[model samples]
Target chain A: MRLAAVLLFLATISAICHTDGYIEQVTQQIHLLRPRSGAAGYRLKDVDCLSWRLAVETNNVRNWKLVPEECEQYVGHYMLGKQYRKDCEIVAHSAIEYAKSLTLVGDGKDIWIFDIDETTLSNLPYYARSDVQFGALPYNDTKFNEWVAEGAAPPVPGSLRLYQTLLPLGFKIVFLTGTAERFKDIRISNLKAAGYYTWEQLILKGEADQGTSALVYKSKKRTELVDSGYRILGNLGDQWSDILGDNSGNRTFKVPDPMYYIS
Target chain B: MRLAAVLLFLATISAICHTDGYIEQVTQQIHLLRPRSGAAGYRLKDVDCLSWRLAVETNNVRNWKLVPEECEQYVGHYMLGKQYRKDCEIVAHSAIEYAKSLTLVGDGKDIWIFDIDETTLSNLPYYARSDVQFGALPYNDTKFNEWVAEGAAPPVPGSLRLYQTLLPLGFKIVFLTGTAERFKDIRISNLKAAGYYTWEQLILKGEADQGTSALVYKSKKRTELVDSGYRILGNLGDQWSDILGDNSGNRTFKVPDPMYYIS
Candidate 1:
């Protein structure tokens, strides 16, 4: 009986040790790597708060005040309109600052290429409206341009400050996107709504190039920029593709994208 | 200054939120998937205690009783050795009990596969000597087989009982390893030293033309087992690959490998 009891005890211990339930193992591995004080338990509380906020945003209640039309206008005016609205003014300023920052002494002129989606526009409101966190959806170009043309987009944080700083600096801004050129009217109208009027070029993927991978499309856009006699100063985007152009730029800055993938 | 302080305070809170990091993300994903957490964190105290004890045994100083030819054997025999001695006696008895419990099929042929490393012999002594937690250096096959033939492996908790029980119940035992066949003699010797001499086969990698990919090699091993006309009743290993046969299995039992990758 004593032996049996001992065996049972050993069995119990072994069961506890061996199971690969992932959480315990992961927690253990992390703890092994970085010992944390008891205070680390409070991290759960933070997680709870974040999860609650996300849940609230995604729920049936329209409490976050998602102004899609305003958002579009905000994106268009600042990204293109060159106006100095308090919230949406960064795009124009950064464009000018960036222009001056470039010293293209060689035969190649400098091009400032940008990514679409979160880089140029604020899309958290749209995510809030759709109640989706990471799901893929089609671009409603008509509605998007309509909103942009209205100049209703609230300025994205840190964007206008940089844009305003860049533009007066003498670098010609170029907008490159995977959005097909078939949506040129809406795209242009959207930028105009946001106050974007002129640029060296605003290149979008053609209709025949719709289903190709974003990397391939973006590479092609860089080639176009190069052909246009511009040495890329720096590419700015939320995604890796924008910054990964061949010999296009000397530096790359990535802004955080809290919502949506262009790919 | 007051406004700046407030802005800093808000920024601190926001930064804290972002730093919540990968743990929260993985936990949230797990919760969303709703997997059975069955027997996972169920025995946390025991798991912690066991891991702690192992750490102590590996680290303790006065425990050094053997040095020269048996320096390796000394650690294995005394620390893990004693544990195995206890396990073998218990498991031998339990194997009989387990054998009675099994309902043998009409085929009257059953096979038991054991994962090497932590599953059978004490591989920890090798790692313990080097104080390296990660990489396993290439095996010294001749030396390993000699050690194995010497019959000096410590028993993992609960393993002997299971192995013992299954043997008498008409189950043939085999040791299958991702370790190459060059070490087969040492491996066999090692098993014999541990009182596990009934192994019908010692299957190793690169022997029967199965390449190094974990998925492919394990599946190939299973094909050999099935072709031999024996039903795989239960598989024991320290990795997911050991039991998840070329993507099929009957019953799977796993042990923890705190040292290195078995797959």
Candidate 2:
């Protein structure tokens, strides 16, 4: 009976060791497999967050809903820090210097393209509201449309300076936006109120463009501008799709946007 | 006895279901954690490969060793296909066009910087050998140094054309390499044999640069060049460190390099 008991004790010890080994191995594997959350303090710890971020920013993935937890830090950084403002200022400064070196044709054909929303206008106030805070809720079109109709959004700080500089340099300034044509009057009022006084054209998506992706619609519009004998010298935007695609201008500058992504 | 048997059966079923649920949860987590390998056929599935590639290419992370498996696809893509050649040709074509548009000051100070290895010279033959295939072995400095001493690596395709184009355009061609200055004779011979007949300067790292990282060494060298009244209009290389840092020229173009990375 003592021998049996001794054997049982040995078996229990062996089982405990095996279980500990298994747990350690699994934990190590989990550590290896987990995606790095850059810098730390981020909630999401998977490649889904990274891939989605890159895809949306680069315009490789379009028109996808964002989970709240995934975008919290991005939104927080944009809304709460000076990083975004500094980035815009630096990009604008570079654009100014680059433009100064160019000898314009003096034919009014040299043009610069600007995008609305986060590029030329700020919408942080709307995004900061409790309903849309952290991007937790699905994007509500009606609410956003109402906000646009208010025509109260301010200018994106550095962009107005860039706009004013390009105008006197003999380059025609054009505003191209993904906002629907229905909001044209309100967008114009908002732009004018925000210190964007004059532009050659304000191009917006029409009913016919509703079915197509932003890339297709924007590329088509750019081609039209090219065909109209306009030389797109510089294109600036907060989204990759705004500066990419056909006839994407001579030089494209991307302004940083982390609060929300547009397709 | 019947009640005990029933209870035992229920417990077994519950354990099996629990095990299955645990497995399903783990698999889902794994899927979320895995990095998208881009375009397909890549073997590495973890985020380490993706982050490392981005960090190295963007000059965010430097002076790091690469695991063999993570770099296998990069090596394979470089050695087995014409993708690398095509990318070089396209970049060179754009550079040619950009240079053609410029009206040079004709001061003999307009300079174009070229990196030597993988930028101007191809080392495919050495990398294709069985002993060092797939970067499976740790980097052998002695073997690589011997290969450099051979004076046999061919000129990188399209780079030769670019070099020829720039020479006649009144742009001073400068070769900046991280290779030690001790191999100056062999490197010059290699360049001469590979159709790079003349260059304004061939700057190689010296003993004083040995202790510094590539970025510091290269950036310091570039500052010296700039202080000498040289106008660096265009700089081209296969590494991010080559085109980044102090006095890194006006326009920098990156040629593709998937085989290996240098700090």
Model 2 residue A93 CA deviation (Å) reads 30
Total residue pair clashes for candidate 1 = 64
Per-candidate chain B TM: 0.55, 0.76
Name the weakest run of 10 consecutive residues (lDDT summed) in model 1 chain A. Answer: A30-39
- In terms of docking quality, how is candidate 1 classified? incorrect
What is candidate 1's fraction of native contacts? 0.00
Alpha-carbon local distance difference test for all models: 0.46, 0.65
Query: Per-residue lDDT for A1-263 in model 1, tens only?
Result: 58557556645643212111122221111001111211111111112221222121111011121112113223233323322122122223333334444565644265567765566655545433432212112234454445444434443555655655555565567887665565567667656555555677787777666655565677876876677667787676655445543544655554433222232
For each candidate, report what fraction of the true interface contacts it reproduces: 0.00, 0.00
> For this target, which candidate reaches the highest TM-score against the unseen true structure?
2
Q: For candidate 2, list the clashing residue pairs, or say none.
A: none
Regions of candidate 2 where Cα sits further than 4 Å from its true position? A1-263, B1-64, B67-71, B134-136
Structural similarity to truth (TM-score) of each candidate:
0.33, 0.45
Across residues B127-228, which tens digit of lDDT does each residue of candidate 1 receive?
A: 454422121222234554454455456656657667776666667787777666666676677776666767677887764543344445777778877887
